[model samples]
Target: MTALPQMILTPLARYGWATHDAVDRDEGAVLRELGRIGEMLGARIAGRAGAIEETIRPQASDDAHPRSLSAQFGLNALPFHAELSHRPRPCRYLLLGCLNPGSSGAATMLLDWRTLDFTADELRLLESAPVLVRTGRRSFYSTLLSPDHAFLRYDPGCLEAVDARGRCALDLVRRRLGSGLSEVHHWRRGDILVIDNWRTLHGRAPSRPSSGRRLARMLIDA
Candidate 1:
């Protein structure tokens, strides 16, 4: 892994056009510096700062290829999974900047592999040839109410892995997230949450959409 920068930018709480805007008319010099710093940190952690370029994508929508995708709720609840696990390509780093927040229940939940318990059989299953995971039509098990959106499928093949341990490590992650949970962090505007897409699995808790839009931009570190 490359070395990360000493400077760290915490997520902000308040919202403003010029300050947080990605394509602001009056962009701040700090934004430029932040991008540079992002490059450095992303390279160190993910191996390529530019790995998440436009040729690849993170969203399921085909119309507008946005590096950032806004997640909202419909009648059905959303399930938890990595950003993109089905296809061959996925971004290394996912940066989420929350624009608006809802009521108390909208928490951003995640299952960390660092501190999860794994059974021997589950470990064997995970270590066995990468488990074939399919999303959408490809999935062996069908999910309810086919989403218009594209969700990443995480199976054994997704890992560009060589050793069994690497495969096993990822498998352990899949085993733990049997069903989504309610534990999550509620986002505040200007709050930027950076997730190691490969290391962690994330999900959203059920909530009733309120007055404003919970708009957010997802950026690949590259």
Candidate 2:
């Protein structure tokens, strides 16, 4: 169930992402399959995490797994953000393998920040903007788009404006995305998509319960 990670790595610079076919794949046993695949790609499995993979499917926010993305967002669309952005340091890469394509309405959405052309003034303001990001009982201040790293750390759900600049930056970012500039990653059964989590913002489009769409996700380190 694993793809050649090196093959995906080679073309990532230009494609922003890569894909490999699982070929004659079966959905019933892919959760453990993804875990094994994640281990092959060096998944950070030694932390507090209970497992190295997750199954994404439609459910109510009040479901048993309330904290899950499937529960929080349900069949609705999700906002653009990196995986694990709420953590102290997000995962470096992500892999998503399609199990069920559903009714075809559930597509993965992507927005590459490197392609955004921010004005010098806006960039300057963003570099200085400091927002308090809350993660449960923990919180930290970050500029979101820091110059020290190529990655972007952002999640609108938890950002609390710390100052005028932070507030402006937050509003500005929201407006920027409001422009509707993004790429759509359509999925097919047996297809695996690899993403550089640090370099791209990703989300999900709407789905219907009847579609039966499902995807397996895994996070790995560099």
Looking at model 1, report the run of 10 residues with the lowest lDDT sum: 10-19
Regions more than 4 Å wrong, model 1: 1-37, 43-76, 103-105, 129-175, 178-183, 209-211
Worst window of 10 by summed lDDT in candidate 2: 43-52
Per-model TM values vs. the true structure: 0.51, 0.83
Q: What is the C-alpha RMSD of each candidate to the true structure, in Å?
A: 10.6, 3.2
lDDT measured at residue 120 in model 1 versus the true structure, 0 to 100: 53
Error of 2 at 16 (Å): 2.1
TM-score, structure 2 vs. true: 0.83
Error of 2 at 203 (Å): 1.2
lDDT (tens digit, per residue) of candidate 1 on 1-222: 344432232321111011233333222432343344356545422322233321211222343222222222231234455565543444445555554554533667655433345465543444343333444455343221113212233433223334565456454555556632324556665454556555455665554534342533344534
lDDT of 2: 0.72
Give the alpha carbon lDDT tens digit for every residue of 1-222 in model 2: 355567666766665677776745787554555555566666553222456566667665565253445555766787787777667777877888889888855788887776677788888787788888777677777777768657777666666788888999888877777674788888888778778788778888887666787788788886
lDDT of 1 at 156: 35
